[model samples]
Target chain A: MSKQGSASALMAEQSPGPLVAFENVSKIYGKGDAEVRALNGVNLQINAGEFVAVMGPSGSGKSTAMNILGCLDKPTSGRYLFKGVDVGGLASDQLAMLRRHFLGFVFQGFNLLARTTALENLELPLIYQRIEKARRRAMALEALETVGLADRADHTPAELSGGQQQRVAIARAIVTKPSLLLADEPTGNLDSARSHEIMQLLTRLNRERGLTVVLVTHEDDIAAYAGRRLDFRDGRIVRETRNTGKPSHAQ
Target chain B: MLSNTLLMALREIQRNVLRSGLTVLGIIIGVAAVIVIVTLGAGTTRQVGSEISKMGSNMITLVPGGDMRMGGASGAAPPFLAADVEALRRELVGVSAIAPYAQRMDQVIVGNENRRVNIVGTVAEISVVRNWKVTDGRLFTLSEERSGKAVCIIGATIRKEMMAGMEPLGATVRVGKLSCEVIGVLEPKGQAMFGGDQDATVVLPIRTYQRRIVGNDRIAQILISGADSADLSDLKLQITQVMRERRNIAAGERSNFSVIDMTEVAGVMQTTIGVMTTFLSAIAGVSLLVGGIGIMNIMLVSVTERTREIGIRLAIGATEREVMLQFLVEAAMLSAGGGLLGITLGLIGAASIAPAINVPFVFQTSTVVQAFLFSAAVGVIFGFMPARRAARLNPIEALRHE
Candidate 1:
């Protein structure tokens, strides 16, 4: 499936709806005196083709909110909707299917399987999708080429630099052509130059393919790359702002 | 998908070849032990069967006794007489031949060589009853047996050792104090089932052995060969009945003699070997249990080590089943590979060792197949808990693990 074509078609059919929505979502860890509240009545939305950044300190629930958005965790209360379908109502397996069909994930650790080559790492999601070997190889190479690491396909993560490993991780995330790419601190392990390179790659994917991007970072520059930013503090969204400094094609 | 998972599992095992090999060492030894023991046990059973058959399948040995297997006849039981053998010969039907048997341990000297040998005294019918054939000369004549002639039949071992380069048929060997002429050389019968060599003996006339060796006419045992078409049990019943009446034994009392059918002895031996094989295999199976535990232990450690990898797979849309299957396949391959190696080693060991122990090398296909299936099952059973733990891991926490 062409992600751009499906995204535009979905936008034409569901023009006014947000692609992902959280309604009064709250998450609490324990019940009694030792209880901890991670998110409190957090409401948020991201439209199609939008690049949104979640910015918060260590205990500010930014990671918790990203986990809910990625369908890795369920909200304790209220509802999380992806394409107007209630994610909390679906079974664990069904949620997995939803993630497989529509979402991709990038971690701060790059999380490419150790000792596996870059091309094989990129083929991970497609392998889960049960794609045939030849087609999956072709798609994985195309994704690697998109991230400008086509020549490094045969190298393992141990052989590649941090920037190259991140690029491989990005290629893996995009190999299935998922509409939503949820990247949690994608440049957290890279230097300033590599971090900018990774950010630019995300921006280009969002611009050219209409792939909605959700980034979690505390860095001001990293957040500046997004068209919209939500700052979390004390288990709630303390502020929301739209950036005018960086002209994003999605915006 | 299954093939892909299997390939991935194989690759994972290959990544740590030494660790994998170390982890499966217990299994290798376990399977190999079972294979070797079972194969050797089968070989011994077959050897016993053939040895017993060589002694004549239709032959029944009568011994005056307590328990025959515990030892030979107890001295308390009255010995059989010449009348007992004659009565069995005349009264029993379906009997091809009968012989009065008596033996003594004595040294035989031929020139300078002196070796201890069994001095068996029996009638001319012993050759027919025991299925023994003379390879060199003729058996003692009936007149020689009746008239107490100083003639004997030497066995192959005596022929080989005492008369190696000379004509054995007419050699005179000293049987204790008597210088007996060897009229014939019996065919080499190799070893007996229990112990001792069957071919290390000298046979003489019963009258001659009685007059010279013991100065008595008491027969220690009797040998009877049943007609091939007759049921041995029925023939044994008839012989026992005749002996009981002739000995004037009461109806409900224990008889002084035991009639042992050679075929029954062979059957009992086979059953005993079968039981022993099962017992030894069960003991070997304990090591397999330990090996299974070794697999489980390593698999748990692998799950812990690969937590982050599992998280990555889960986040990338791999289901819990897929993760579990990967580990399960890995463990199965490890144990099954061990089983194959064990079979090969076991066969090699058995093949080389069977002849050393004087038994045939029996390759049991069912045993091999069962061993393989059992080893694979060991892997699956032991691998389950670790695979489940890996599958149930929280992706969020797992990704955060070091």
Candidate 2:
């Protein structure tokens, strides 16, 4: 039994499949007259260690696709597979387990708990993961150091600047050592200089850590940083671009 | 997970001190009210029971014409005669002693000191039946009592008021128009439960009192003392039957007189107080429900205000159960904390007010624990809807809520 378990564990570690897949997925918001087709049978695949950006206008359903990819919402009539396991049939708790083990999220507003220190905010995910206090503290500090905000671990969000808060939010996202980092307009609230700093951090993290990233942004310069890009329009991916050379907007 | 949730709940409550305090006010008042009312009720019942038992152990009083509890209005119904008392003594078994007494209010002059006091006229057996002792001098001799001598027994209050520093025994005091010698000073009996001075009266021979005071041989009350092994109710029944025969009352008609057992009176008073305590506590419990509603209201507002926070948590992989547990824990902590505070306040309130109301401060550990658990349950019951609302929020919409 132990030998079989070890064999399966090794196979799971080197699984030969796409990390995420959307097979003709669709999401409908309402019924009949008020129906809104948020995703229209879109198909996509993302492998390990890839930095991808999704770009679209306000009503083009890019956010809906991100929500589905993040497992925050289920597809209406199609399958979403994560690590070769179908997610549409999973219960809510199982979906939560998937999110906890594999996904990390960073929002546009830098959603750190207010009035809480940066270290505590970073420990939030680890707490949910049921990690012990000593290890959780150490991991949170390590994540803060990775985001270059270890000195500000004791400072509350209200005491930090917008870029610093975003850094804390990024540290919280990576604190659990998740497989995929999901960032939606992570630099939307920052100035140009702060935005450049955040982008540089994301790019370095993607390259150095080989962390898979799925970022959704509307700005052309923001999307330019990713190695691959997809443009959405009218609930469908209209175009895909690959950058084999250096990023066009690199410093 | 539960501890982490509880810690988070504590942090959230601490973050909004004023709001949390206001939310728990109803629970505080409700719990405090329940504790105070019930404690005082128990104290009062205990006080009444002890005081009544102190009057005489295993004693019963038969009043002519009416029930003692109903003011004993001896207006038209005939007074009990001496023959009725004699018959009870002779026929009733297990009766240790019996004393028939007639009382009248009259001025008793002791030189410069004079006071209007209740003058009790009864047999020498009254000292035995009432368990009264002569602290000084001696009780009337059998010959003195049989010949109707004008010898009196002054109670402790009379001794303190009329005699003061002087020795009261062997002193002569004028009772109404008649002169009486003070034969003894009765032992002090403090205040009665129903609010009369038990030691303020003077006692005299019944024959002398009948001849000089009222000019009649009528007896107003008969006090009976039963043996330690006697069944008081059975003795009371036998006495009632004998009295019915003596008065020639038919079996179907209600007797004009009443027999009161002290223990039964104590039981009735305690039961009545227990019922009142339950009733008042129920009213106070209603306030606890209102407090629970307050917690629900605040929790709902918190959920709405923290919509984006909930979204962030959901996105970061908190389960719906965890989210609900967070809110429920917050509410339970608030109510339980309030209950604790109320217990302390109620106990203090009861203790301070007990002396003023002449009752002992009484409380039980079970009462405190039950109150605490009950308040916690109130939080969970009332907090379910709000916690469910928080847990069921769509992450997308919650994230977008302003």
- Among these predictions, the greatest TM-score belongs to 2
Identify the runs in model 1 with alpha carbons over 4 angstroms from their true place: A1-16, A244-251, B66-71, B177-181, B212-214
Output the lDDT of residue B5, model 2.
93
lDDT of 2 at B52: 71
DockQ scores for all the models shown? 0.64, 0.73
TM-score of chain A of 1: 0.92
* CAPRI docking class of candidate 2: medium
Task: Kindly report which residue pairs in candidate 1 clash with one another.
Answer: none
